[model samples]
Target: MGQPPLEAEIEIAATPDEVWAAISNVAAMKKRSPELVVMRTFGKPKVGRRSVNINRRKGFAWPTTARITRWKPPTNDGGNGSFAFYVWPTDVEWSYDLEPSSTGTRVVERRTALPDPSLSVRLTAKWALGGADNHDTELLAGMNATLAALKVEVEQP
Candidate 1:
């Protein structure tokens, strides 16, 4: 079976459009993401756009590529909005969803590892990258950190 998606959420004291403005700058991810060392986009962030990322953990750094598959702007009323990308050279999809709330905006980050992982990818994730549970735990923490940083950025006056 495919691994369950890992997710984290945080409320930012900003509207959905404000939140989207901060998160949609995929090329600037390295500045906000705790684990992403670098990210470079080939074109504007939109469905079908490609990007490369380098992530680090415990002194180890690895590279991955991804293609944007979904890109939806927040509604004018500050309702739900989301964008997602599929990581290549592996079966992983990462996404961010935003929803307006009474306090401000709720931002959710998700990571889904495709169920039909190639043997090579599975082994790499299990052994080289730490076991599945360990990796998921780290990812959750990173997502929380990323969202917290973003909240601070968007809430600033």
Candidate 2:
């Protein structure tokens, strides 16, 4: 069987635009992610924008370059929208989608459409990052933590 997609979702007490603001800011992720140490973007979030994601675990830090592939702000009519980027080396796209809901706004984050890794990269992931299964577990856990932290931050007065 194929590997599972890494995903998580959360309902926030804010509007879609509010949630969008929080998630669109690359620098703000340091506050929302327990594993992310820093994210530096070369330009504002837009299609083709480039950024580097730096993550740490047990004192080991690694960086990955990414390019934005999709950037749709929340519509005024409360329609579905998404922000997404493709990370290099792994070639997986990470997306954050926004939608209106009864409670407030539903925010979904996912890592999907991962390209098959080359043998060397696969070995690196196994040794340094973790095996595929363990990495997916970590990604899912990180998504949940990120959404939960953003919910708390956005809900605060």
Candidate 3:
């Protein structure tokens, strides 16, 4: 509606599988995420698994539990490793994707199904922040930072 989805993509010097390892490991993610304060597993990490996500380090600090709505491991369709974590009833889908690239690999994050930028969106523009920026500015910056850090972490020999 407002925008198809909030997508941020960056190319990292690494392989697709290597990138997947970084995204798949919840423990590692918690440790590496600059803003991620805590991540606890409620069950196994699979298609039907669930986990609690606590985001901090910014002016905002909130904890939310999400279910693994999709667990896909690069099967055709661009063969980009993809997974979706749903916070439930919010219509928001936090998605991750990885694809091989000439430079090395490309990582993408799509925070889709966000509330269409409408009357309510304009009303809460100042108070609500979705993608790094309150109205989405430094989102790609953060995504790039994560991808760069991830590339460094994965490309180590």
All models, RMSD in angstroms: 1.8, 1.8, 3.9
Q: For candidate 3, write residues 42-104 as lDDT tens digits.
A: 766777788887776458666767888777776445558887787643347777888888987
**TM-score of each candidate structure, all chains considered together:** 0.90, 0.91, 0.74
- Tens digits of lDDT, candidate 1, 32-145: 887899888897888998888898877778888989988998974447889899997767889999998999899999988557677876787777779766777778888998
By lDDT, who's the top model here? 1
Question: Which window of ten consecutive residues has the lowest lDDT sum in model 1?
Answer: 74-83
What's the lDDT for all of these models?
0.84, 0.83, 0.67
Best by TM-score: 2
Sorting all predicted structures by TM-score, with the top scorer first, yields 2, 1, 3
Q: Per-residue CA lDDT of candidate 2, range 58-141, in tens?
A: 656788889999999887445667899898777788899999898889999998845678775587567877777787788788
Residue-pair clashes per candidate:
1, 0, 0
Off by over 4 Å in 2: none
